[model samples]
Target: MLSSSGRGPSLVRSAILLAIAALVATFFTAPAAQAADGQISGLAGKCVDVAGASNANGTPVQLYDCNGSGAQRWSNPGDGTLRALGKCLDVSGNSTADGALVHLWDCTGAANQRWLVSGANDIVNPQANKCLDVQNRSSANGARLQIWTCTGQSNQKWNAPASGGGGNPQPGGFVVSEAQFNQMFPGRNSFYSYSGLTAALSAYPAFANTGSDTVKRQEAAAFLANVSHETGGLVHVVEQNTANYPHYCDTSQSYGCPAGQAAYYGRGPIQLSWNFNYKAAGDALGINLLNNPWLVQNDAAVAWKTGLWYWNTQNGPGTMTPHNAMVNQAGFGQTIRSINGSLECDGRNPAQVQSRINNYQRFTQILGTTPGGNLYC
Candidate 1:
C-alpha cells in the first residue's frame, strides 16, 4: 500500500471533480445537491429582493412588490442557504443579536450566510435565531429586510423555493460545541451525531438561546443529561423494550395510524412514542411524520428534532415547557416534572429521577457551570 504522501497526483486529480462557482467549493465540502431559483415573496405578495438590482456586495436586501426581475430572484441550493446575484443573503456583522441588517455579501460559509426556510414559510437566520422580517412590519415597497426575533407574524412569513423550504435546515450557533458534546457522551451511538443535533437546532431557534450565557449552558446541559438518560448514555437508538412497540398506536384519533400499529414506537433521543406525538412533531416541523414516523429513527436530524420539539414546546405530564422551566429559573427539578413526571416525579421513581439528576450534574460540570437548585422534582 502506498503512503498517504505518495498519492499526491491522484488526490489532486480527484479534487478537481467539478468546476462550480468560486466560493461554492470553499463554502461546502461537497458540491451543492440542487439549486432551485425562484422569486421569494413575502408580505402582501412582495418579493424579498436586492435593492437596485445591483450585483455588488453589501446591497441591502429589501421587500418589494413582485416584478419578475432578477433583483427579486433567489436561489436555494438545498444546502440550507439562500443566495442571489451570486452572493449570499447575510446578516450584517455576523452578529447573533436581534434586529441585525440583512444584505448581500460574498458567500464565505460563515454562520451569518446560513439560513433555514422553515416549513411555515419563515426565512430564519439560524445563527441569530431570528426571522427575515420587513423592517417595522411595513409592507410598502423597498422595505428593507432584517433579522428579528421570530414571532410567526405576517411580516416574517415568506414563500421561498419549494425544494429549499422543508427537510434539512442550516445549523448554527449551538451552545454545546462538538468537543463538549463528545466529552459528555463519549460512548454515544453513531446515530446521535453532533451534526444532527445542530441541524435540528434550527427547528426551534430559542432552545439554548433563550437567556444569558449561564442559562444557555445550563439549558444545553439539562437537555443532554436527559437525553443521555433516555438512551442509556446515548447508546440506544430506539427503546429497547420491544413489548411497548405495538401499544403506541391509538385508534381514537380522526386519522388512524397508517404506518401500522407498531410504527410509532419509542424512537429518537426522547424515545418519542404514540401516533399523536409523531403527528404533532411532524406538523410543527413541517415534515409529514404521521404516516412516515420512521423518519425519526432513520434520519439523525429528525431524531434530534423530535427530542427538541418535546423539549421546547410540549409540556408532557407537567405544567410549563421544559424550556420555560429552565429560562424562568424554575430549577432543574421542574424540568423533570415537565418531562415524564407522571411516572418519575414525586415519590414514584426517585431512583430514575436521581439518575437524570446525576447525569445533569456531570454535564454541567463538563460545561463548566453549576447545576442550579431544585435537584428533585
Candidate 2:
C-alpha cells in the first residue's frame, strides 16, 4: 500500500481517470439523449405570478406573460420546491391542513415547502397533498394559485416555454417556461449583484467571452452547469469561517508576514487571500494590492479579476491551453501544486491551500479533461 503522502497524488490520479471515463461515456450518450428527449429549456420569460393580491394564500393564480420582474422569477431547487422572490411556494408552513393557504415564506426546509415536479407539469406539494390550484377556478389575468387537494384540474397545469421562442405547452401540466427563467437569472449580468454562479464566471472575462452568440450561449450553459455543481448552485462560497463571521482577519505572521504587517486571511472568489496573492492580483488587474487587499471581497469586479488572474497567471491557463493540460497532465498537476504551495507562503495549511487540489479537480471536470497523469512538480 502507498503511504498517506503518496496516496494523495495516486487517489487524485484515480479520480481523474474515473472522471475521464465518465466524460467519454457521457459524450457518446448525450447527443442521442438530447435528440430523443428534447431540450430542457429555462423558465424565465414565461413564468407568471399567479394573479390576485400578492399577499399570501387563497390568491387567484393566473398566468400572465412574463415581464422579467422579481415576482416572476422562480428558483427550482431541483428538490421539488419552486421559489419566487426568496419565498417558497409553501403549504402554509406545512400545517397539513386541507385547503391550507399556500403562502410564500422564507425557506425553512419544511416538508410542506418541499415539492416535487411531476411529469405532468404539476407542482405538487406533497405535504399539503395538493396541486397548486388557481383561486376560484379563474383563468383571467392576475389570478393566484392556492393549494387544494389534487384533483388533476387544468388550472394546476403549467407550461415551461422554450428559450428565446414561443414554446408549446405540454399536455396536462404546467411548464416553468424557459424565457422567464433566463430573464430572471440573466447569465453573467446576474453576477454583477452577487458572488454566486453568474458572478464567478463573469469574473473571468476570458472564460465568459463568446466569439459569437452561439458560442457565447454554449459556453455560458456549460460554465453554469459545471460551476453550479462545484459551488453548490451559488448558495455556497469557498471563503473560510463564512458560517461564523462575515470576515476573517489574519492574526498570524508565520505564513508570509511582511516584516511589520499583521493579518492575512483568505477572501473572495476561490478565496484569494494573503499578501502575495493580493499583490499578484493587483499586478494582473492594474490595481494597488498593498493599498486595497480587501477589494477582493468588497468589489465584485475586482474579485472576479483576481480569480481570472489566478486561473491565467498562477494556474497555468495563461501559458497553456486546457487541451495542453489534458495532454500533459503531469505538467498541469505540477502547476497547480506549485500554486497550492505558494499560496501557503504567508501561512501553511491556509484553508484555501487545503482545498486547492479539490478545486483543481473541479476545474478539470468542468473543462472536460482527464485528471490523472504525471506531476510536473
Could you say which candidate leads in TM-score? 1
Write candidate 1's Cα lDDT for 148-221 as tens digits. Answer: 65555688877776444433432336778899999998888999999999877756666775546777789999
After superposition, the stretches of candidate 2 with alpha carbons farther than 4 Å from their true spots are 1-233, 236-238, 242-263, 316-377
- Residue 330, model 2: Cα distance from true site in angstroms: 12
TM-score of each: 0.61, 0.30
In terms of lDDT, the poorest run of 10 residues in model 1 is: 12-21
lDDT of each: 0.71, 0.39
Badly placed stretches (over 4 Å) of model 1 are 1-63, 66-172
Residue 372 of model 2, lDDT score:
53
How do the residues 250-329 of candidate 2 rate in per-residue lDDT, one tens digit apiece?
33323443422433344444345545545555654557755666665567666555544443333321233222232233
Q: RMSD, each candidate, Å?
A: 16.3, 20.8
Error of 1 at 238 (Å): 1.2
Error at 255, model 1, angstroms = 0.7
TM-score of 1: 0.61
